[model samples]
Target: MSTSLDTTRLLAALENVAVISTTDLQGNITYANDLFCKLTGYAREELIGQPHSIVRHPAVPKAVYKDMWDTIKAGDIWTGIIPNVGKGGGVYVVDTTVQPLRDAAGNIDSYISIRRVINDLMQNFEAVEFSKETFDEYYAN
Candidate 1:
């Protein structure tokens, strides 16, 4: 296949699997692609104009978000694995990349986040952490 064909295929695959969103500089959600709404169990009307934190899980530490904000605000990209809470309190995990979009003046206009779920890997990690916690509690006596 030609390079252009390969790039097109890759982008199609990414669109199929990735959840994408854009937020204004102050963190209000501006747009959410269909996959994002489906995965989060929110309708487009419900998601638009809401804070991106609408999907945040408490299990994710505040410091992680702080780091993401700090990095993006400085015009750098931030990437990390994040735990998120979906509708009905369901949990999901995603490998996320946050990028700042700059306006013509070189100031940030908005931010785009692309995320892909890592289901089994994150579930296993959560299981291990649970086991560790259980073991610690048992040994504390």
Candidate 2:
């Protein structure tokens, strides 16, 4: 049992900080929350009907997306750390979860993605990778 007040507060908190978007089965953007639009630098009107791949970053391995799609298409939720490109080519990292929405007839209707920016974590990871690469290069030479 949940009170309306509790639900409203939770919704408000998520809306204020979370990047949320929904896409059709074909991967066209159907809905994007205010936070998502602000982060992506796209107006709601511009995003609608556009492929969700618009924000995909080249640095992210293709296998990552393939796994995500395979899992969600199988009606399972997919969670991963994704590097995305924002407007103006700014790179951002997000901890993302995508879930398939099913219709009443048991068909997949769409996908809903919830993402939280993880800039600090991503920076640390990048630094670690760079250090590893530099050390390997020096020792190999």
Report the number of the highest-lDDT candidate.
1
Error of 1 at 81 (Å): 1.0
- Local accuracy of candidate 1 as per-residue lDDT tens digits, 66-93: 9999999999999999889888788888
Clashing pairs in 2: none
Query: How many clashes in candidate 2?
Result: 0
lDDT of 2 at 63: 93
Clashes, model 1:
0
For model 1, give the 10-residue run with minimal summed lDDT.
1-10
Which residue pairs overlap in candidate 1's backbone?
none
Candidates in order have lDDT scores of 0.92, 0.91
Model 1 alpha-carbon drift over 4 Å, by segment: 6-11, 123-141
TM-scores for candidates 1 onward, in order: 0.79, 0.80
